[model samples]
Target: MGRSKSPVRVITAVVAMAALVLAGCTKPGPSLRPTATTNPPGVFGPGADGLGDTYYPKAGNGGYDVANYDLDLKYDPPTDTLTGTATITATATADLSRFNLDFTGLKTEKVTVNDVDAAAEQSGAELVVTPATGIATGAQFVVKVTYGGVPKAFDEPGLGEIGFLHTDDGAVAIGEPEVASSWFPVNDHPRDKATYTVKIAAPEGLAALSNGAMKDKRSAGGWTTWTWSETKPMAPYLATVVIGKYRVKESTHDGKPMVIAVDTSLSAQVDAQMAQTPEVIDFLESKFGPYPFDALGGIVIDDRRVRFALENQSRPIYSSAFFEAGEDGTWVIVHELAHQWYGDSVAVNEWKEIWLNEGFASYAEWLWFEDKGEQTAQQTFDNSYAPADAEMWRVPPGDPGKSDLFHESVYTRGAMTLHALRVTVGDDAFFKILKAWAAEKAHSNATTPEFIALAERISGKQLDQLFDDWLYGEKRPPRPRR
Candidate 1:
């Protein structure tokens, strides 16, 4: 994900003030403690309500691994209602009497576990399910939940609004950190990747766009159901559904499906930017190895409220603001598409290592410009290093706390870290490290230490001091040199 560049001091101050005002506004979800059950003593216990993530502990449920999500959804624009059934296929990782799913806002009409009626309850954002029979470790189970509501965005204090946004004509389901729970019952973290088949039913005239290749589309009565299947394992946050009037272009690139869409309300230039999808992917593949997903495309949203472009799997979603005023937003395109490898395919194991996502993508933007003869990467690195942004340097990109997840250092300084490695190890070994990392970690989760280890193995260097200074130090390190 990338936000439009703004003044550093202004953005930081605004975000800081927003955090203060919104502090303690949102309530925490229930604990992940084992709940009492009427099964054999100590044999069956409730699954933990949350995964023990360092930053967002309650972000995902524990004790089960999701395999696939089959979502059948219908939205009525006039009434702003979203009704859906989520059929989740998962395998229990431990003995369980009951388990938890991250969900909120919507009213659950019914729930069933493995074709049996199951008792369920909603507590805060957690949907606790008690199946009739105990699910043993390694046992596969199916959960079907019928639910509906007027979907609402999560109004995070400093982060702004995210999740399901009821738009003028249709709706958009997208966000970072946590958004899937607002729309569907989900595991809700990058650590648990799963395949998806999304079937969205909307008014006959509107377009409903989603990830991967379009499987089928049919119109019945006054509604149209659009089916999309993302066979690749994708983090829950990368799944999105965009519904509204759109000018869509569908074609095949290199024998793979390519679908690009722009809101009818935006200028034609947005479509032009969207047209650059194939070219950008081709360029990134040369540096990051094969593109990780089966399909590729982009979505340019008309909503101005969306200030950033998210690297949604298979298809990245762009805020129309990026292309406003006839600005050339190709760099934004490169940043998000680069995430197809760095962020989407090889996701971060923990949110703290976000630079693994943002940094590599930001560096891709520099590489793109250098390829276009606009600026060399060394020049970009020199400029960033020369600057004395104390706040940026102080907040280490590798461990920027939860509040500064998108801090400037995470992008700019993070890129400089990569360039420093290139300068230290030379171009051949540097590119090799990148390609090898993508190839080995494709469609999986990774971390900074893992990346550093890969770099060291590829380059034959003891680079602890370099990573320590660049990624963790509170003060800027010495400039890079051969």
Candidate 2:
């Protein structure tokens, strides 16, 4: 995600920043390793409510690993209602008679487990489901939930209003840390990544956009159904659906599907900026190995409420504020597209390790500017380090508390950490460590320690003290020296 409500140029001078339902048998894919233990053979127990994330303990559920989510949804713009059926395919990691899905707002009309009617009740933001029968460890089961209502956005303390936002012409489902629950039943954390098949039914004239390749689109009656599929395992937060009137442009880039959508109300300059999508991807690919997804594109929304741009897997969504006054917002584009390699493809194991996502992307912005001959990365790092704020040095980027997750220190200092490492290890090993990290941790979740280990291994340097000082130290450390 990019910085909140700031122009790319202003933010650069300051600091670097920061779903459908369906019920069906999803193809078997990679599953998150279960964090909970199995019960006795015949014994049954309820799945844990949360996945034990340090920042948000109640964020994701435990005891099952989700493989896919098939969402068939219909939205009425005039009435602002969203009705949908979500089919989740998952494997029981333990003996479970009941499990929990993180969900909010909508009224659940019905729920079925493995085709059998199951009892479900909404508790706070969770949908507690009691299966008719017990599921053994390693047993795959399908959960179908039929629900509908006016979706509501989550007003987090520091994160602001997120989740589902009801717009004028349509709606947008986007957020970080936890947005999936506001729209669909989900595991809700990066630890449990899954494939997605979303079928959205919207008014015929409006375009519905989502992640990955478009599978099918057909209009019947007054509504058009847009079907999209993402075969690559993706974190729940990375899944998004934007519905509204859009000037949609579809093409192919490097043998991959490219779909860019801009709000119809936006200026032609926005379209021109969107045209730079492929160029940014090619530049990022050269440094980060191949692009990780099958599709590439972006969605530029015209809502002032959405102040930040998010790296939503294959297709990212940007706020129009980035391109105000026809400014070149390619730096923000680079920040988000770079996340296709760091944050989206290689997600953080826990929210605390967000620097793994924000840091690398911030560094990518510096790299892009350096490539353009505007400013070298070393120079950018020096600028950020020169007048470092006390708060920035006080709050460690490695473990910024939940409230300070998107704080300036996380992006600015996080990128500084990488530059410091680059200075320590030299360019050859630095770039090699980056490519190797992307290749090794592709389509998976990782942690800061794991990254430090990878950097040490690839560069053949002891980097613990370096990482500790830059990532965790409360005081600013001395500048890097070879």
Candidate 3:
């Protein structure tokens, strides 16, 4: 969400190549393998309350992994009330007597497991559900939660205002990090990826938009329902729902379905900007390989309340201010679209490695300018590196901490880290690393160490020192010379 806004300047500094250590960076915790010995003669126990992620430990639940989500939601903007039914299908990783769900601020009407009534209790952000019978390890189960009330849209302590946000005319659901729980019950972490079938209902005049291709829309009793299904596996943060009055356009880009929506208030100014979306996607495809998603499009919500754009699966959410900036906003479009390949397709397993998302997307912007024959990526890095502000390099991109999740260091310095890596590994191998990383990890979760391994594999060189200096060092290291 951070943007570099200074004129181009060039600087030079000394950089060095370092040793590669495969086991150096943070690694995922030991996987919990369910075994019969762990349970006492089929007497099931409760699932773990958290997934053990180092950064946000309690963001996702344990014991079960979500496979699919069927979300049916109805909202009336006049009353600002949201009624939702979330049918979650998951496979238990261990024998479970009860499980937990990440949710907040919604009234629960009823809870059912496999069509039978279940006991549901709300403790802070956790929804504890206990079914009548215990579930066996590896057994598949279904949970349906019926909830209704006015959804909360409060600011996340460190991440800013997220979740279901209200606009002048309607509401937009933007979940990143851990905010999805505010709207619907979810595993609520990037590690637990799942397919989603979102069915949304709103007033007849408003258009409902979500991730993936729109399947259909039906109207009954002054309310219209819109159905969208995302077949590919997606992290919870990338899920989104926008309900408002807008100008909708359905078209094809490079033989793929494309859907673009602009708020009626700013459609005139945003249409031209939105039209260039295809060209941006095409350019990214040429560099990053084929587009990762089945669809290619975006939604422009003209709301001043939300300040940043998000790479929400197939359709990235944009703020109307981008259009108001005219041509200056093109890079922002390119940035978010680039994330469809980096952040959405190949997600980070832990929040600490968010550089895997923001860094790649930020570097993609530099690649765009370089591809356009403008100032080379080195020039951009040089200008950014010239700044003497200690805060810029204080927190390494790999360890931005909880509150600094979206720090400017993560975006700019993160991109700089990649450029330095490109310098360490020549262009041919560096570009190969990019494409190969995306293709291999498509629709899966990854971490920084994995990316380092991939880079070493593709370049046939050790890069531990380079990554350590640029990503983990407290001070800014010398810029790599190409």
Best by lDDT, which number?
Answer: 2
Q: lDDT order of candidates, best first?
A: 2, 1, 3
- Scored against the true structure, residue 121 in model 1 reaches a CA lDDT of 99
Instruction: Look at candidate 2 and give me any clashing residue pairs.
Output: 20-71, 21-70, 21-71, 21-72, 22-70, 22-71, 22-87, 23-87
Whose TM-score is greatest here? 2
Local accuracy by lDDT, each model: 0.82, 0.84, 0.79
- Per-residue lDDT of model 3, residues 243-351, tens digit only: 9999999998878789999999884657777788998988998888999888878898876666567888889888776557442566768778988888888877778
What is the overall TM-score of model 3 with all chains considered together? 0.92
- Listed per candidate, the RMSD to the true structure in angstroms reads 5.7, 4.5, 5.5
- Which regions of candidate 1 fall more than 4 Å away from where they truly are? 1-42
Give the worst 10-residue stretch by lDDT in candidate 1: 20-29
Score residue 26 of candidate 3 by CA lDDT: 19
Clashes of each: 1, 8, 1
Which regions of candidate 3 fall more than 4 Å away from where they truly are? 1-43, 157-159, 325-327
Worst 10 residues of 3 by lDDT: 16-25
What is the Å distance of residue 272 in model 2 from its true position?
A: 0.4
Residue lDDT tens for model 1, 1-482:
12344333222322232121110001011222112123344487788877766788887787788889999999999999999999999988778988999999899999999999999999999999999999987789999999999987886534578899988999998788788999999988788888999999999999999999999999999999999999988888889999999998999888899999999999887887788889888999899898888899989888867777788989988888668886567777888898888888888777788888888888888898778766688877766677686577898988988888777777777888999999999999999999998888887778788889999999999999999999999998888766
